[model samples]
Target: MNFKSLKTLAVNGKQVIVRVDFNVPIKDGRVIDPSRIQAALPTINFLCEQKCRIILLTHLGKPKATHDPACSLQPVFEYLAAILPGVKFAPIVPGTAEAITRSQEVRPGDILLFDNLRFHTGESENDLDFAKNLAALGEIYINEAFSVCHRKAASVSTLPTLLPSAAGFQLQKEVEFLQKIMEKPQRPFIGIIGGAKISTKLPVIRALLEKVDYLLLGGALANTILKAQGIAVGKSLIEESMVSEVKDLNLVTNKLRVPIDVVMAPSVEPDALSQTVAVANVPDEQRILDIGPETLELYKMILQTAKTVVWNGPMGYFELPQFEQGTKQLAEIIAGLNAETVAGGGETLEAINQLKLNDKFTFLSTGGGAMLAFLEGKPLPGLEPLTIE
Candidate 1:
């Protein structure tokens, strides 16, 4: 909350480097989703209004500190050019003299986008020398990539220290909404957590368990919890290593709600025969694919009285039509609520977008791991240097 805001900075006519999250899904050299890119428009437009030479720095999919053509930002640049005419692409390697030269050539009111930052060796390593070289590209740094705030990558954490830094509109908005959920959510706050693994979400789950009035569990994650409590999960996905850790969380709390019934199937195939069964009656040959109608009804009843709701992940394998009901119905239920609803993570947003209920939520975060880390009360390295010390 103490971070400097982009609007408060004196950035007139300056070459400003804006770290944005344009890491949208790309297939066959075309962007599949432009939501992440769209989320950053407000910040980019504000810099344009100031006549700043806007230089964009971002990473696509992980290139593992090596140059990968598949991870190139060319497709993204093409997509951006169509929306904002005259936006230039600096195809040169980052942290190089050529890159710096391209930066210097950018005129005020022009936007220049660099290739993948991860294409450089020092990017993921958080090398200060790399950051110093990058700093020469601009006079100020504005972080608009809230989704990458949890990382300690060079562009995220180190480069900010080399220049006057501030949080962009999108980052500021993300922080404000998440902070409200963590600090002082309205009473009757309900949190719904689902997904495939407990390993990644345990911290957030533990944190929410202490804060939320009710915490609902579903998906493969619930399977692990159910198995830990001596219930038969059959061949369902369960993290054996995490069962002990889950048991230590003391599942006796009235706030924690696990599924009582689930839809089971032999496999996730489209033609797999499936049926709804009580949690205790899961067949030895079957796996839980989605929450059953009884469980959905139970969750709906609890959500009705919520004053605030935070959801991450989906209730089931919603990619298939048959298994999509639980997640679809959950979205409809939450959207119909009058409460403040906040949802995040890739799968969760995909489900919401599929249901066409995006505008219904109070906020849909672009972050997945970053949102979880923020909600877990963990300090994000990328955010630390941006703080007003």
Candidate 2:
């Protein structure tokens, strides 16, 4: 569905309900990261300028029934005050008439943030009564929360059915950018798949094989592959169950590139004795925390000639200094690439910052699970319902 813009929805000084992803980390009752808040500015600013009465809805950390002060939207209000100082902020609790009453007071250029939507069990259950009640707040709904698009919640999937819905700027950008990769990526596309478990990344791996010219494996997932190839992984955390399956998969895809060498330590501890070994032989006591030097050079060589690159996950358990080399070097390679580069996943996102290459990549996605689900060809519940506009 071709969604109307915010400008198209705000008619007759209507109350516009916007669904946003304010699920950012909080530390010591303070917002530690404001990146998600920053991403929503364009949409918020546009609605305000249109003179629409704006009411925003979002959910924070998981909370039980009734109000939990810990999961309150107070921190998000505080964050908005800084990034959008001129906009007024108010908090509304879901499922209460007070929320709608408070929202009615918002004038043009004003903003009101609702309390944590999860406070009501109906939000996740998609209760029709709860959806209709939320629908009462506005005549129009705008979905700007791409991070939770995979979820079917009151604020994301259900509410849009009660009002004329549209896609917010960030959501639109996510669709357009990801569509490029699926449709017509540049030639010799290099796909780097990583992350902790083989199970989580299996769909993306299968998807990439159909389009990627070269597929490079890393992180804990690579450990399984290494073991599948008769390598002694040592004390490295290897999934015993996946090793045999990977060996079976190898028979179908000869294009898969597993690490040739790796950096290992007796344990993940920093001071542990570190050494490199060929993929064939690793000490039984030492764990393979990261990829080794030879593999880094091989990956770098592949990146140099690629016309497109898509990456997910980190190459190693990069939180520790001993195993950070693989992820760090991979980040450097992505930053220096002459190709069109796009990367996602939480660990990879953190590694990009640690390597100081956040600004160098073509695009760094804010959604991890949503990104993977999109590549897997799954419908995004948050986006699907909002398409009715």
Highest lDDT scorer: 1
Candidate 2 lDDT, 1-389, residue by residue in tens: 34456556545467788888888888787887666777788988887677777888888989865788889888788878876745555555765788777766777767778888898888989888898888888778888888888887777788887788888888888777888877889988989988788877777788888888889998888887767777677777777877776776562454778888988777777687778888777877778878999999988988898888988888888888888889988899889988889888767877786667878988877788889888878888877765544
Off by over 4 Å in 2: 1-4, 64-70, 86-92, 238-245, 251-254, 269-273
The per-model lDDT (C-alpha) reads 0.91, 0.80
The parts of candidate 1 lying over 4 Å away from their true place are: none
lDDT of 1 by residue, 185-251 (tens): 9979999999999999999999998899999998899888898888999999999999988876666
Candidate 2 local lDDT, residue 269: 75
Q: RMSD to the native, candidate 1? A: 1.6
RMSD of each: 1.6, 2.7
lDDT of residue 111 for candidate 2: 76
Candidate 2 Cα RMSD after full superposition onto the native fold (Å): 2.7
